[model samples]
Target: MPESELGGPEEKSYTAPGKVPLDSGWVDVPRLSLSASAGPGAFGGEERPFDNFRFSQRWLREQGLDGSHLSAITVEGDSMEPLLRAGDEVLVDHSPQPFRDGIHVVRLEDTLLVKRVAAQGGGRYSLLSQNLAYPPLEVNAQDIEIVGRVVWKSGRL
Candidate 1:
């Protein structure tokens, strides 16, 4: 057998078997310790990165996500059910752009929440839930801080 065909000294494995190599065109985004509530829950006063999730760089670019501004947070309720479920991990973009009417993660009174926000045309937003059991929450735009926009979500089937 030739040297190239054999387990040659020049060839080295950068990662374990069945794992993606570091230079394999994948990027890691931090999974934050914060949880975005779909119901009523308060977040502890710590913003730490717990772990990282690997995603294809090409795919992220296609989705128009900036890797530097991307982070993941876990969902903690069923208010956005059928679209976002409890324990679902969602990708957030922290870019400071004009807010559009869409699903977003917001911080209100120290609680982080994920809800569909509709522009009420008077510096007010209506927070809506997919589950009809929860009523829509209306708030003045100045009260809540928009943490980020939910760009993607993943959950176990």
Candidate 2:
């Protein structure tokens, strides 16, 4: 038999199997999402794959994202609903640079919010809400922190 074919149909590691796992960590500019999908029926004994619980801590570490310069968190609140649905995912860029007028994941005194940020300057900016019921806000440099700019947004299609 050919060596390749002799390797248990070329897929299964039936003999002396090895195990490897994934580790994910969030650091600066965290707009990471852990999404999972599954089929309706069972074709074989295999289980459906789950979404990423966390990104590779090693990857983030090697890339230096775990430092104070970057961070990522799940979004909450309905303020950014129309453009950023409650469950949709976002990536934050925390390098502290000028962002073109758009949305961002802002962190204030005890709260983390995802809102549309219209840049003002010198650590100040305007927060606009897609929902008119909630009025826009003008924030000062000290009032809040820019965790990261929203780099991307994704959701169910």
Candidate 3:
């Protein structure tokens, strides 16, 4: 990854894959995408917000996700910072694909950590913190349970 793709605390040296480094001076996060974005009201149609109840219960269930397949968990901490602030609502894709290097809510050991996935190191994985104050934490695969991938973060604009 390019130097710009990597970021973290000034005191930590986290050499993880797909890591977006956070520094005291690097506070500006832009709209980054691997592909071009669809502009508002111009991508054939406007994007619609997910109706939590129907989207999570009936629709998603009808789409093949059983009752045990999903749940709405209110985010409770600032460990995720700007990307996933406390009180924000995030839809957890319970029936998620195999753990990959991306964002996900993970229950490692006894702690539930909502951090950006960094790498899958055979028996362990690296979790990146959006806030520089919190250094990256390494958790063992066996000790961690993959909750789900964070589909989208919704909150006040």
Candidate 4:
């Protein structure tokens, strides 16, 4: 049998089987301990990173987003279903952005939530949900704090 036909010593695998090799093309974004409620709401406690999610550096630059201003949080309900489901990890950009219509993570009182934010004029905004069962929450500029904008999500199909 020829050495080329059989597996040779030069063809050794550096990475173990069933393990994903770390790629330099990707960047690790911290996954925070917080959970953004997609339904009612979840308490915004434990502002610390528990893990990390790998993201493409090129894609971040293409989106005009800064990785240092990004964090990941898990979605906690089905209120934003069809778009963002329960247990989905969402990438939130903490960078300053023009408060326009889009999915955002907001701090409403003591709770943290993920919802579609719409400008209502005169410094007021409405938090809308993808699920029709949940009604939109109208909030004033003083009553809510925009944590960041949801830029990406990783979930099952």
Candidate 5:
């Protein structure tokens, strides 16, 4: 396997064909084919897992995250620059819960977006971009669908 396809330095022990190793110490989180745009919205398409990202199971547990509830997706715009740049990969925690003030993946109409969501009182929310070039969008809570909360992000220096 190429370096990108390999996980950590730990050797992979196999149990049976096509089955996850019993004690690999790491888990493969699926990367969805869809992207969450940081600027203009991207089409919110069907869920399709195209790849897997390996992460230490212990580290996930330490962070109070359930690996089974995690998925990865790429960022597709520069609106969230300085914090989340284009091409960055983000881990989404698909836990069902009330929204809080944070970065989250949200669906507005037919488009998917990644933005800083803040409660604006009276069933309203403000989707703020890190880059000031774009104006913040004020929306009603009912018009937006919360895909998941962005628990972690990875990007090149």
Candidate 6:
């Protein structure tokens, strides 16, 4: 048999054909095709996964996260600059829970926005932006839908 088809001294066949080697200690999280706008954009649409991101399971566990609770979405617009720039990809946690103070993906009216959220008590939240040109918006707790809490953000430096 040829070296390309047969096992070689440099290569070990540890996994079946057309399968990823799970022994490598890496897991994949789905990257949704939907984009979450950092400024004003579309609210809701079809959420189809277009790609996958590989991450170490151990590292995710260390961060108190799991693949089930995580989903990746691309960020659009510069309303949340300085912290979350335009075109950044953010990981969001979809665990069912009450909203807390942190960066989050929220839905106000028919628009979806990525903003820093602060609990203002009395069932209200203040949506803020890192850009000073954009003013903070106060919204009633019931008026907004908390899509997910932003856990991590990544983009080109």
Candidate achieving the largest TM-score = 5
- Error (Å) of candidate 3 at residue 130 is 1.0
Model 4 pairs in collision: none
Which candidate do you rate higher for lDDT, 1 or 4?
4
Residue-level lDDT tens digits of model 5 in 98-150? 67899999999999999999998999999999999999999999999988999
The C-alpha lDDT values of all candidates are: 0.85, 0.53, 0.53, 0.88, 0.88, 0.81
Runs in model 5 deviating more than 4 A are: 1-19
Per-residue C-alpha lDDT of model 6 across residues 1-157, encoded as one tens digit per residue? 2233455642644455434455567777788877777776656566788887888889898988887788898888888888888888999888888667999998888777889999999998999988888889999999999999999888999
Per-model clash counts, in order, read: 0, 19, 6, 0, 0, 0
lDDT of 1 at 50: 81
| TM-score of structure candidate 1 | 0.84
Tens-digit lDDT string for candidate 3 (56-96)? 24444455544345444445556667776666666556774
What RMSD, rounded to one decimal, does every model reach? 5.0, 12.1, 20.5, 6.9, 6.2, 4.7
Question: What is the C-alpha lDDT profile of model 2 across 1-157, one tens digit per residue?
Answer: 3233454554442323222221113322323332110111111222232233244557756655444454334545566667665556665557757567777666556455667778787777887777677777888968877656765556665
Whole-model alpha-carbon lDDT for candidate 5: 0.88
RMSD of 4: 6.9
Superposition error at 157 for model 3 (Å): 3.0
- Per-candidate TM-scores read 0.84, 0.52, 0.55, 0.83, 0.86, 0.83
| Model 2: ten consecutive residues of lowest lDDT | 35-44
Give the distance in Å from residue 112's predicted Cα in candidate 2 to where it truly belongs. 0.7
Global fold similarity of model 5 (TM-score): 0.86
Error of 3 at 24 (Å): 49
Model 2, position 132: C-alpha lDDT score: 71
Candidates, ranked, lDDT: 5, 4, 1, 6, 3, 2
